[model samples]
Target: MTSITKRKTFLILTSLVSAIAILLLSLKPDTAIMDDQTLYEKLNNGNTIYYLVVGDSIGRGAGAESRRDSWYAQLERLIKKRYGADMQGQHISQSGATAFEGLYKLKNTELIYPADIIFLVFGENDRKYMEPEEFAKHYELLVREAKVRAPKAEIITFIESPLAVQEFANQIQAVSSHYGATAIDMRKAYRQSGAEVKSLNRDQVHPNGKGYELYAKTILQTLDEFPNRKAPSTKEALYVQEDAPLHVTTSIETQQGFLYKEPYWTTGKKGSSIRYKVQGNTIGAIIKRNPNGGMVDVFIDRRYYRTINTNWPLVKERYIIIAAGIESGSHQIEFITNDHGHRFNGLDEKPFQLAGVISATINSKGTAE
Candidate 1:
């Protein structure tokens, strides 16, 4: 062969190898690459490293066969094995919780203040019930609150599922970036793992045991990538105004059809109604859900707003946001039972129960009405 021909063949082969390398690099998980470990070592000192996990059902490890098989539990084990450090944390995530509900939980629940690390695993439920913009607003607020409470904590947000919508993932990435936190897009890791994403899920949403294992592995890999160890600075300009103090009231006005039960007002009669008045822009309800839970219509300022069906497969208590983004002032909220001899899951005569009401107004100076 001629010298020119040999050179041309070598050049072509080099170009092909380069293109393949680029493709593989592009297929890797979306995480920042860092080699420094000073902060990591500092956090791994002999003292216990407190952490917090906050989000939806996925965060609460719903589909795992047992608590030990959950992703968070597996991740804790991995951290202990790898770093030889003691760790402690709390998981305050609730099933069927949206971003708004997440924010409320963060505000109301007693968190581990000054935690060494925090994981946020929301967005799946938000994508189902909330607009992207509204979700973004609440998510940003949640992140900000975490920062304010745990200024020196390493905040990490997870794109929990492969089936998560693109918009919700984008919003999480954007908010994390803006707040100097790390956002791990697990979808990329799942796609690159060569596993069928559908097989990882127990149902349409929650992950099975095998799926949780994959989740833990992905999170461990991301942590190994040395994501930002620096915490958010309290001196930084705030993105949203601080929320007012939350007001919770269990005192409610009920008609004769309703009977007072410990911790809840229960009624099997149709047309039973309860009323609450509060001063706030955002309002929510604390209610019970069971196999026989019935539906209740919500009214704001005397106009029907939405209907809430408090039915679940098991007896579970939930704090749900029923109304938000209303004008900042006094408002009247009502919940009326609509039981009509409906049977759910072989249970007859579904009943309505109320636990309490929660509200947050814009004014910080006045008491709850």
Candidate 2:
């Protein structure tokens, strides 16, 4: 080939390589807004509703002065102003949390348990370390975990900044589809007639405040009906039988997290009337359903607090732990309802114990109850 032609070809190859490299680097997961360890700490108790939004710097609101103006913050403000004061929420966006970081931060931090709603915006960072296929794998894992941890929480995947372009969008679609999450096309919203977001981007990717204003408007519009609906009901089917022991009556409107079934796990039919006999601290034999002939384990801090031998029936004072599983700090405990059933095999936790009983004697950072 001619020397001139060879030189031209080399130039083209170098330019292509550079562009591809730039695209990958821009998509790196570490570049996300925040990860679990990256705490925004904007927790306020004014609202009864809570949301956990995760993703890159945009999700973290790097462009905003105090991280509060970031899109997530703006969303919170809108919710509080428009919805009411009882809509408290949190933003856990890290400045550079990639998709991988999201899995760790979300799962380890236990946000899923408390989160009534979730806005997951990611993928820009995953582009660097993985192909769309690989990103999809990890993304699926994250979704599965979310399902297990936050069964009631509705997850919405805010499509990554569309300004970054199509390749990323396609990856997001594939991954979101594999995981059964809602894929909100932020790109389409940003490009809508009234928004000037494309022009307000600080970089071709990140946007300035004006840019976020457009983003926020689009998000708020979608979220307008979010708070109006009731939280999800339990998907697990509950069966109560004549001889059924340990039956907990869960209301149809239960939210997706921990539920407390009360001191007597077994709940009798409302008309039948459950009776308990107290023998001092230990519960004496009593009957609710048919007759329990197994040992039901109770939880203290989720670690075997006590056990009840159903050799007889319900005993009021039976195995009520003195001081209720002494917790020295903020702690959690739960018990399985089926543990008392002869053939129960659903749910990891049916009832949970709160800090209602703690006192200075139990928790160092708390008062004695």
Candidate 3:
């Protein structure tokens, strides 16, 4: 072989290698280019960090023996030890909350302060009743609301449970990417841990203490990888209107056959009803759920909407979404008690109770009624 021919082959191979490197770099997701030591140094600046957690049962630290054993609690403790920073956590999570419920709660509740970090720990309960698309819509709305409330906060979405489907996790990743947020898939960490996933869980659904430790470890490792990641600015274009109007009705209605019970209006007799006039595309209610709870038929603008059963195994207050995606305009919503012969612990004539009503418009202009 001639010297020129050998030199030409080497040049071609060098060019091919350069092209492969460029392609790999382009395909990689944008990540913070800092070492662990530098990241820890930045975090250990002695500044107080506020963390806002919003989601379902896992976010509320359910199934853990104590609050200290929960994932977030452990994460805070580890962050204090490793980063030498003080952390405060605020939780707005419910045990059986879905994405819709989470959104409703976020809308109704006021933030005490702007958060430094926001952890969205949903998907387990959402996957049980919501399709991937529906979950994405609600999740995106939740993220939008979080951004508006804390414009500079770092948003992190968690795919925390093994029971959550891949499709749900995919949607979470897609939405997070679109919003410049981060999605941490704990399933990957669980798989890499080489531990039996089922054994980590306390029961069929909730995780045990060891499982929560894994969750904290996974979150910390993921954060270390992207220490300088920023959440999307609220000034940027958002899927949801930042100033969307939400109307809440807490006043008692003067209706026949209904007894005012401090916070709620209770009626055991069938056909008893309460009405509220609200203007929005979405309607929800804060109601009481118990084993003796009965059925309530909903009416929108005097038209029959849907029947909601208020029965639960235990007595608790819940935000129940009555209807969504309706036309934006003034509408009268009525809930009529329709208790059939449903027996709970041999008790007949279940009662229906209403605490408050809420309505929200997506992008329409309206004032609270």
Each prediction's whole-model lDDT (CA)? 0.75, 0.48, 0.76
Q: In candidate 1, what are the lDDT values of residues 7-61, reduced to their tens digit? A: 9999999999999999888766422222122346544543456789888888888
Q: Please give each candidate's TM-score.
A: 0.77, 0.46, 0.73
Q: Which is the winner by TM-score between candidate 1 and candidate 3?
A: 1
Query: Which model scores highest in TM-score?
Result: 1
Among these predicted structures, which one has the highest lDDT? 3
Clashes of each: 0, 34, 0
Is 1 or 3 the stronger prediction by lDDT?
3
The positional error of residue 7 in candidate 2, measured at the CA in angstroms, is 99
As for TM-score, the candidate ahead, 2 or 3, is: 3
Residue-wise C-alpha lDDT for candidate 2, range 1-369, written one tens digit per residue: 999999999999999999999998877754342122111121222334557776666777666545565676677677677655344456656544565556545655655336656777777766654455445544555555566666656677777664264666776676556555567787777666455664657776776677676677776676653443332333221111111111112222212233335542342111111211111111112112223334444444446555444332321122122222133343333333333333233423212222122111111112233
User: lDDT per residue, candidate 3, 61-130, as tens digits?
Assistant: 8899899999999998878886777778889998888777888778778888567788998888777654
The residue-level lDDT of candidate 1 at 256 comes to: 52
CA error at residue 226 for candidate 1, angstroms: 2.0
* TM-score of structure candidate 2: 0.46
Show model 1 residue runs off by greater than 4 Å: 1-39, 43-48, 112-114, 227-229, 235-239, 251-256, 340-350, 361-369
Q: Cα deviation in Å at residue 81, candidate 1?
A: 2.9
